[model samples]
Target: MDAVPLLRISRPHRLSEEVGAVLEKHIRSGEFGPGEKLPAEARLAEQFAVSRAVVREAIARLKADGLLESRQGSGVYVAQCLGAGVFRMAAGVRGEAHPIEDIFELRLIIEVAAAERAALRRTPADVEAIEAALARMDEAVALSADGVRADDDFHCAIASASGNPLIGRFVAFVSHEFSASRAPTWSREGIVRGLAGAAQDEHRAVHAAIVAGDPAAARRAARQHLLRAARRLGVVLAAPPGARGEDMDEETS
Candidate 1:
């Protein structure tokens, strides 16, 4: 009988992520090639010096991500990875590789600059597009429905208004990534009173600055809006994506 392969985690900080990363690395490296069964939870728990619960959570994450699979009564096995190599080289999970704070920081840099450029370059058509998108976003937020798609349209319109396909494309990509990690942001805890109204006001400010062709004000408004949004999201991100945080209970109601 052959012994099960197991690896030890180095740093204990962010245990589930560390464990997940290690396992991910293994599957990606072909050490546990496609269709190879992974060691049982008990053995993995012993190797990592973590509890079975943590191991279960880590495995569950991989399975949810389409990286691994569990058969009926059989152990877990690696999934047939198609773009595994590209994904490994490109980026990691937003919640795991980098804190959600970095996502907001990225928006502060790219979206704010996009607004500034849009103010200088926006044509009549672009302005009209942005205005329409903003109106839809306002309605969606007011209804307390998930405004993520409308919010995306509003930001992407700004990028398109900049008259740069590259900027628009990049903004589109970033928007997808950001929402992938933090969709339905309006539903998070500690969102504060009238969050929808506040966000609408900020969007209007950005739109007004662009419409007035005031590049500086456009940048400033975009900055202030992202800063407020980051603060609210920071609360949600106090926990990892899809999990609850300690402080959330007080703010939940």
Candidate 2:
């Protein structure tokens, strides 16, 4: 019944994200405390000067982030626990100039270790899945596509093969967070070909080491691939723990 402070969205791109951020800020600031019901979707949409569909998307994202919950025959309310103890990509991180670079640093920590375990624990079927994802990437590259999904699938396969479900989940989460970062890099026409080609080669190196069941080599390969990926995006990652601090000369296929 009181006046709402939701601002009208001006930018067209990533409408849902903007709306979600506004609502999340309110929640975090205690304006919408735990168990407090939010305004109806239609009302929120009108306040934001956006469609109901956009409001729905924003709500869904908040739900996924554990900031909100729904009740049967009732509207959405702020979550009671507010995702306590859960690992979340902070809102500030996503707003940074190279947010994905920070995520890449996380991947270097999680995925490099996962790749080593995958080489040790992967079964024949796991190898098949990894190869299948690799094939899809190859097809996308040959067709001059960005292959972002295929690239994600390739890393996820290795995560699955790690024999640790927690590692798999964390890898998938970080990968999702960093996905938007790839679009800009691929959107550039002049470098897409070279970038995709180099990426594919690095992927092959990782796959080869895993297929050979060589844990140390797999670790090395995975680290090199992620480091090279950051380079392709014009990002420089500070060497994470256990990294050999390899230079550009060492990132060969």
Candidate 3:
């Protein structure tokens, strides 16, 4: 009989990361179809030869990355395919020195429209989700500097409430972009505290407008929020080289 060689696999210190990688591979390979429910956690743990805690952590990470979704009393399912626009924004954040002004302008245009639509289309559940996100933002602000995450969550929730999956996906995409750019800025304690306060106020205004179903107010609030974000990035609004006034107005408008 011929001898079979044993394969050795490297063990990662973090079990969750290892599990996440395995699950991610399956997702990318299309082994799990879009919107397909994953097996129960216990079964997944057994199949992966890991603990349920590790499996749960892996699921949570994937969910954060907009790759998986969970339904109450149901199970985890693969997320729908995110459009190219969302992926393009996410792909642009790879150690490149992004122009903060340009990024803020893009965010302003997309998010304001998203807020307006959300105001017009949001359901009662969407309103509750936004309110919950607002509460989290307040909690994060009270707890201090790291509260910017809650602010991000609040905005992302509004994007999701727009009832347009692509909008939600784009929000998730740009979030990573903004985070990468702001990492240096947020490192300063003073900057963090100041931005946290500003974010809370902006989020409150947006939430109020959305709850009231006032699309115009929602758009204004969202636009103002992005403008504030641009200011924080120290970006000056200047005409693009060789562009005429009419051209600039047309582009921005």
Candidate 4:
């Protein structure tokens, strides 16, 4: 078999991401098989000539992406099926070849419905999780892009709150696709500078609608939020028949 090329890390920046790229390439290239245990953290650190923290971060990211799993007191092994489809989508975003707007469109369809359902179906535990995620989002917003994990957690909690296992799993599957793509689009610099506070206010609307068990309100808020995101990303809206530029503006407005 041909050798899999490794990513060359010339500059010492984001060692964890670089490490993840290297390991992901190897895994995709079949250098590592599913259910196979990864080398110990110390060995991986030595191989990459970086500290264990870097390796740990890389592994954490992979685990989050569902590419790997770890059992306490055991070892980290590749997850069954390895979720190559999700990985490819994430890789496309990372390469900047994927259209971020299109992904947002897909997210709009999935999340709006999910939010509506969650509002109707959420149990006490689901409400608690959603509130916790909202708190995290508030904290992240105050801190700017530093709140990526919290923002992500909020969405995941929403998925779970929907009370549909399939929906939650699907959302979790595509969650990482927006990590790099949507983060820059919704961060403090992005939202505050671009939307002039509309973005934050829109999120609040969605949260409130969900909490109130108002499905229609939730759907509307979710659609408006994603539409704003699509506009910010420069996505061209496909106008319906007899719909002019003014109509499009009115619809979005």
Candidate 5:
């Protein structure tokens, strides 16, 4: 029964995700109190200026997050007790002190092990998924686009290939959190071009190690790629444990 906030949907991000974020914010702010019924789907669609399908997807995301519940033959209502708090990563804005280094450190911990496991466990299907994502990234680069979605997909594919569903889910969450910082638009044109090309080369190295079923090589390549990526964004992560001199040497080589 609370007033819905105005939403201005932007490009280059999924509509459902944007809508879901708005709804989540209102719920967390207590504007939409616990146990209160939400507006009808049609009303929500009209309010958000999106189709019913988009509204549906946004609501579904909330349900999955355990922030809402549905009763048979009754409208959706906010959950009486908020379950586990939703995890989020805000887009790093210029001039604001964000923990960019800490984020990359988390990625190094998650993705390095993921790449190693993927190399050992990936099937032909998983390889194809990773390859397809890379092809999309290459095409986006050729068109001078940022390729953020494809880049996200590439990392998610690698995580899924690890054969641990939980790892795959965590990687997707991490990618979403870090995606805003990955866009090259704030940099000069020359730098954007150089970063895109260099990033592609690094991605291919990881792919090559996975295809060869070389676990150690894959771990090294994934770790090196993330480190270089962080530097591109002006972040320097503290060295995680187990990164020995030999491994660092191999990464540079």
Candidate 6:
């Protein structure tokens, strides 16, 4: 009798993550239909050329995502795929560059509105909160650090100052994706000391407009900030792996 062929399980890092990704791929591609029972853990282990423990771990991950259900005295089955948008957003963004632009596009609408509203509604306390966030960023930059968290705080502060709890919550919801997008760009060449300086200045401009109670200027500043950010990220994406370079730099941003 001939033995069945097992797939490769290469990639030495985060075995459970890879396992969950493979299972997610199968589920997404309909290899396992809705409500259909998955193969036994032992069978899955053989198919993936991994131990039952790894398979068990991956199943646990899927269950956490509400993708699978384990019934008493029975095997695991696929859950009905409801709230798919919730699932898509809930799948935390990590180390990937594809979703950055989409996230930025969403930010434009929300952030522009927030900036305009902040200009109209900002109080003494709101200004203080924003300035404190800026101060943190300044300290980070002076010490040559990643100010990504402060950057997030600055934006969220603006959302809060807009006087709408809904806007603040919306920004918070999309923030994980936004931060994931920034991680790669912030690590790019010319980012820490070069473009970061520009970003700091841009943020100051937005703050100034908000403080001066100029809604139009705040809106323009916020819009321009995102445009510059997108350009900078593109420069980073063009760079080669492990090479701090951005080729095709003719179209200067």
Query: What TM-score would each prediction reach against the true structure?
Result: 0.54, 0.60, 0.58, 0.60, 0.62, 0.55
The digit string of per-residue lDDT tens for model 5 on 142-191 reads 77766887888888899999999889767754565656556662234724
Residue pairs with colliding backbones in model 2 are none
Model 1 residue 127 lDDT score: 93
In order, the Cα lDDT scores of the candidates are: 0.74, 0.79, 0.73, 0.74, 0.81, 0.75
Candidate 1 clashing pairs, residues 3+ apart or interchain: none
- Residues 35-55 of candidate 2 have per-residue lDDT tens digits of 899999999999999999999
Model 1 misplaced stretches (Cα beyond 4 Å): 1-97, 180-184, 188-192, 235-253
**Candidate order by decreasing lDDT:** 5, 2, 6, 1, 4, 3
Error of 1 at 42 (Å): 54
lDDT by residue (1-253, candidate 3, tens digit) is 9999989989756989888888877885669877899899999999989899999999998887767888899999987642212354433666465466667767766888999999998989778878887787577556554544555656677888899987876776666565544453344463455775676688789989998999989987887676666666666455458865653563455
Best by TM-score: 5
Candidate 6 structure quality by residue, lDDT tens digits, 59-80 = 8888876668888889998865
Better of 3 and 6 by lDDT: 6
Indicate the residue-level lDDT of 141 in model 4: 62
lDDT, candidate 4, 25-136, per-residue tens: 7875558877789999999999999999999999999888778889799999887545534545634456554667567757877888888998898888777777786676
**Model 3 spans > 4 angstroms off:** 1-94, 181-193, 238-253
- Candidate 6 yields a Cα-based lDDT of 0.75
lDDT of 1 by residue, 84-176 (tens): 322321246444555567677677678989999999999998898899888887776656666766777788889989988778756754565
The collision pairs in model 5 are: none
| True-structure lDDT of candidate 4 | 0.74
Cα misplacement distance, residue 73 of candidate 6 (Å) = 25
